[model samples]
Target chain A: MSTSADTVSMGGGNNSPSIRAKVQAFGGFLTNMVLPNIGAFIAWGLLTALFIPSGWMPNEEFAKIVGPAINFLLPLLLAITGGRMVGGQRGAVMGAIGAIGLIVGADIPMFLGAMVIGPLGGLIIKKFDGLLENRIPAGFEMIVNNFSLGILGFLLMLVSFEFIGPVIEAANNGITVAIEALVATGLLPLLSLINEPAKVLFLNNVIDQGIYYPLGMQAAAEQGKSIYFTVASNPGPGLGLLLAFTFFGGKTSKRTAPGAMIIHFLGGIHELYFPYVLMKPLTIVGMIGGGMTGIAVFELFDAGLVAGPSPGSIFAYLGLTPKGSFIGIIAGVLAAAGVTFLITSLILKMDKNTEETEEENLNESIEKSKAMKQEGKEVSAASEQHTTQIEKISFACDAGAGSSAMGATAFRKKLHKKGIEGIEVKHYRIEDVPEDANIVVVHKDLLDRAKIAHSDKEIITIENFLDDPNLHGLLERLENVSK
Target chain B: MLGEHLKGNVRFLESVNSWEEAIRESAAPLLENGSITSKYVDDMIQNVNTNGPYIVVVPEFAMPHAKNENSVEKTGISFLQLQEPVMFPDDKEVKVLFALAAEDSTGHLDLISDLSGVLMEDEARDELKQAKSEKEIIDLINSVE
Candidate 1:
């Protein structure tokens, strides 16, 4: 089942999940917001590539779809999705209303602005809904709900409409000017310094969506292609790094790196190659060198893609490539991979005298990345000092037959009543609480067994499954976090 | 589904000497009907001995069960209402026991859902607790269903 754990930080009151976990969770959220609407981007990219005046098939009628789709439809979808993540269905509606303002206000497409405004609108409605909790009279719930959203959405539309104009004007000047400065300086390849490490730490989304996409879109709007999109997403470095490990790594790493290479290069999932780099941290030098070469090549050729290549796969890169950019794009990817492989192979050969073994690092990095991925699923874990937003709560008992089932069911009912979203309540045996669970709840009597089963976890003990003081505290804490 | 499973599996008892005896007595109906073997009853008691009184899920309520381990022939639920509360580990005073014999985890969920519904609301819990006879218990559980 596609559970909602990956994008939210689901932790209990006591757990202190690592900072890496929080970043992955936020990255997961951003990726979800953009990944779903990528089809729209591709459709627009296809239309633009095929039917624009300079294109091979240049159909005026088909090309008409490109402008409106990127300008209105794509941005609206992003805003709607952003809203739904924060506020649910109603939030989605609010996000669209808010985003329409930015689209009309800005001279350019509002991808970056829509991303910000969508969540803001969702938060606005979610907070408003939270306030309206228990205050609505029973019979007037329908009318109050309708009028409230209608009235709030009307004002939100106006606020965003007016607010977006000034925000876009400032952003236009800021990003466009900064980018032009960077282009003139010829130091774009230095971005690999940030991109390589951030990718391994699960910040690929942040640097891609947060920095490059906006820059690329702006430059592309003017020149039909920009080197910005290819800077961070080039998969060549990962390919080189993994290929090096496949040839020169320890026994386990050598065996594993080949499979990872396939998934990373052709599959375009850069995450597949991270374990290799993490196992041999020094190999990052090779990745950085590869990335720099790729960027330099792209800049030299003045090559770019029509759309951002999500997953960073070679296939996606080729698909999104503008007609004349093929030569340069392919050259950049090959050059980057070749450079990274050469450097990585040299490092692996030299590191034979080091205390660290490639297998050990590989194993630890695999485990660490898994931990980070799980945390990413935990939607919005606020902090340990404050009550964290919980996503998965496991109700554990000796058999997981009767009592735990009853506890999970009752807790689900409470969550439903309180309008808490994204938390998964399920019954599990004391020994079988899933690795993804943010908290484990057990009857106080079984504390010893639970401790023995999961010594690493935070345990919530209760005397009564239905009505316990501790459970009451957790409910209050959850309510506060959601608010 | 729960009411059907619990039809001939309900019992009312005056008392039991120990929590182990309470589970044996509660599961007696399921055992006699071939839903589970005597080993299932012993394993349910052994579960508490090893894990303590966690089976006493709420005040005055306990659900005794263990891994089927090939001891269960069919899934079934049996309820027993003790006239006087029996002392369990951790000094839990339990007056009701729901001895579960599940063939597998997912198969017995309908019955579990019915039981949760019965216990979730204060009014329904009080109603089930006040029930006197086997028919009354079955009727109360069914009402929630």
Candidate 2:
């Protein structure tokens, strides 16, 4: 049931196939370039996790490992990789040179900034290479190439320092101001409200890579660890929800929740549990409660991480924890789990009838969808003002497969039973909704997210894919337009 | 558990022209057994065509099925193995097809879960792929229990 929703960001255009292709190409580049280096990132995570001052190796010699790795080597390695992706060996060197400029000139990790500058440096070098392709004399090629590269490296370093460096610093400062205000107002835990929902919406990258990474790098550079790194990356809330579902859920939950828990908690793909929460929007309170609990304990114990854990794995969590603060982190996670379990159990119990209604709605929608084929004549009469017809209907979920795929199957059968032909129906991950999709169907909980991602597209929200009356209404609308 | 229904329902075909042909050939046994109507087979094929290949659960496996809409007379599963795999447009190739017809969405989940459990075991899957007779496939399903 694995769906391709987590990574694909669709263009919000019915006519813009070019825009869709560009978005897909960029998404592919980002995923291919960055995903392979996760091992390196995890290794860096391990180093900072275990060798920091409060870690297993508290010796001064081991503590020395944290500085150069986080501040220089890791970011430099990432830049080299990104540059190699965009250009070749020469671009890799310029990318590293550009990153080094940022590393030396700034107080933060500079890794996030490197991702952008590295590609830019690589592109510049590639352009230079292209310009000089046949212009250099054969005899003086080596000399010319070496001297020009040195000059280019120096120029890129200047560009990183004099230009991009200040912009990054300013962005970091602005985020810091917002965070400091929250902390100053004694509302740090309130971040959980925003963070948990955003994470479920698959906006973890925006919050982590876009905002927290720079701040965390700066914080880690100053201190041994940064709490900024741990704020949203913690898996405790997700773990709590999954645990609750496994123990106290319905039949489907009991069957699937355990597998999801292992993948989510240990494997560190928190997106696995998002559908469980989406199935019941009321359970978001559990997530909020768990998040608040974890953050509260982190603050109370002053527990922090040497670097941001990408997957938020427990091993990564412990690896980054300061010496005595390990217990605090554990306590925070357990407390979050306990609170979430209690809230989720209650919500699940209360929503039993609502869940039943959802199932009924699904069956009803199927019946109505089938009825549309027989009632095609009635639809054509209503077509006078309806010109915007939906050519394609796509069902989208967290990963795009489990619920949405099944829903699409049921819907398709309904259409076929009614003798409705040629209308395309497909399923995708919410992020990967195809540009041509006229109506994007998503679980009700993801309505806000679908809107944010594709504001111009017509979206249909259902409590669950099985029982949505909206699908029938949408088909009626489509029929009117089709006529 | 699935072995009881697999008696006289399992077949290993030499080849097929397309995935739709493979699906129809797989479901033929169930249709003969009165487990499903011909409409059910058409609906299942239509599902695969419209929704891409979500049915191809594993590298070389697919379970082609559709939701019940008076097309299913009973819950049944027919197993077929092709000598050469049929390729779907999505790059998923299916050497084995499990044509499932359920009375309702939740009706045959337990059987599906049990079947998935067996399919996931490499040893069981390898045995099923190579088995020439129905008894061997039944024995493998029994061993899973």
Candidate 3:
């Protein structure tokens, strides 16, 4: 069982992440993309609140900023951030390039689409760059890197623009049909299933204003009250969601929820709460639950706004409330809020419980890494030497400056002299050695730092940057393995 | 570029009291020509203070450098050779110091490439300790570079 990673590839024994861990990692990536751009969304919501025709201080000209902002700016930012997360700066460029195609090609704002495309673009370029990595001649790296991205991005833009329309059209059609089928079931509360999800996707207007408001208006003409108006436009569910976040959300979400609440509940900007749902995704259950409760409450008391509440704010809700229907309307909103708050708090609490333990394990792992390092080193060193499949070797120094760079440069020269290929040798600060590096070469002097920072990897300690005996041993092992 | 940057920045010292004094004395040329500020000298010393003597790239050859952090006005390299070796931490003796003042990370890699080229071979590294003049040291670097 004790095998020295003498062949240079250190991670042959590492286990892959479990399903839950993989899902959480993906979820964390989603949260990272949405978290930074929430401020931009808030700004757009504030502008929509103040300037839209249904808004408090409606201004025709200033309101024009809303459409372009939502359609172009917010989506682009999300794509750029997502792309950068996967691909680095070039990925960001690729993300933006790919996103513009989606924006121009599709009729919708492309929020979710951009999220997908950005990372896809980043991944594309990252792979392309990886393929081109040492193959580019020394003097031509900059030109090759830029042109590869430029050409790939151009083709990606064409591909996205050419093919995205049918996909978006298909999704929009699917949502509309799902809404129609839910309405046909006559189980009014069931509408929340479609409504809540649609609302988060910026499809609020398509369902509420397009479908429900018309149906409610027709029903109102006959009976002076209908539950359709309250079905999707109830600000209760959004308010409850935000309130739950204020009390129970992650740190940044908690700090920002109060402002979002003000915009969602009072200002009637339902879009304000969309990012919160997008972040947790599971919180959509809370939204649907609150929504169904609100609709059931309205139908119980035969409550309806005589007209549609344009902005769907609490004020708008009351202003449109038929006089005798006040109690019913108020009760519906309150009930929805209470139900959503309870459900969302439970979800957030459950998330936090898992998160806290993950954090504890993370802290424990730091301490545990020392023991693991010793065990790993002994096993690797004592066992038969492994064969070479070394993909990445990181050289680390204190400031990422002197010794590490020298070591890395010299090691690269040795690798080239030995005609080794596909093994990435690079230097970093002691703490910045990437997770994917199979082996970290640190000077014997900084062994403690290397062990603490990168305990998961095989560590090779050398006394000299140029010609240490360990270096010679490693080189000979590589030569034998390569042969 | 590597030889040109070190043209007038080479000096000879008989000995230094400690590795700290060796680094300070080694980096003095960069300070005089305004290639780097005094803070960079302090950072390089602090790097050793916290990180041990990893900057001593070879057995008796030390390379002192730090994150520029706006402390370097331009990229330059300097050299110092001592007749009597100085005792670094852990009893490692260093006779030659290469003070590297890079304004940014990638700018002065050629200097490192040449330095590594010089030290990679045993005979050149041994001759480096014996090189008597600045021109001789520069030519030795050029010979391998």
TM-score winner between 2 and 3, please give it.
2
Q: Which DockQ-derived CAPRI band holds candidate 3?
A: medium
- State the lDDT of candidate 2 residue by residue for B35-114, as single tens digits: 99999899888876665565665567777877677988988888999888889756667898878887865556556655
Off by over 4 Å in 1: A1-18, A354-356, A379-483, B1-145
* Per-model DockQ against the true two-chain complex: 0.47, 0.02, 0.51
Q: What is candidate 2's lDDT per residue for A1-483, written digit by digit as tens? A: 012122221111122324333333443344444556667665665666566665566567766866787778777877887787666688788889998888888877786777777777777886777567546776998998888889999988988888798887677677788997987776888888777766655456556755665577667667656777777887888888888877777666767788888888788888677767655656778888888888888888877776667677787787666666778888887787788888888877776666545544434433432332223323332331232245468887554534555556656655655655445677776788888788888766567768988898988876424435787776565554544
lDDT, candidate 2, at A448: 76
Per-model lDDT: 0.80, 0.70, 0.76
Q: Which stretches of candidate 2 lie over 4 Å from their true place?
A: A1-57, A130-148, A354-483, B1-145
Tens digits of per-residue lDDT, candidate 1, A127-201, equal 787677657887998999888888988887787778865686687679778766877799878888878877876
TM-score, structure 3 vs. true: 0.44
Question: Model 3: per-residue lDDT, tens digit, A382-460?
Answer: 2212212366888888777667888889988998898865568888888989988888999888899889998788899
Best by DockQ: 3
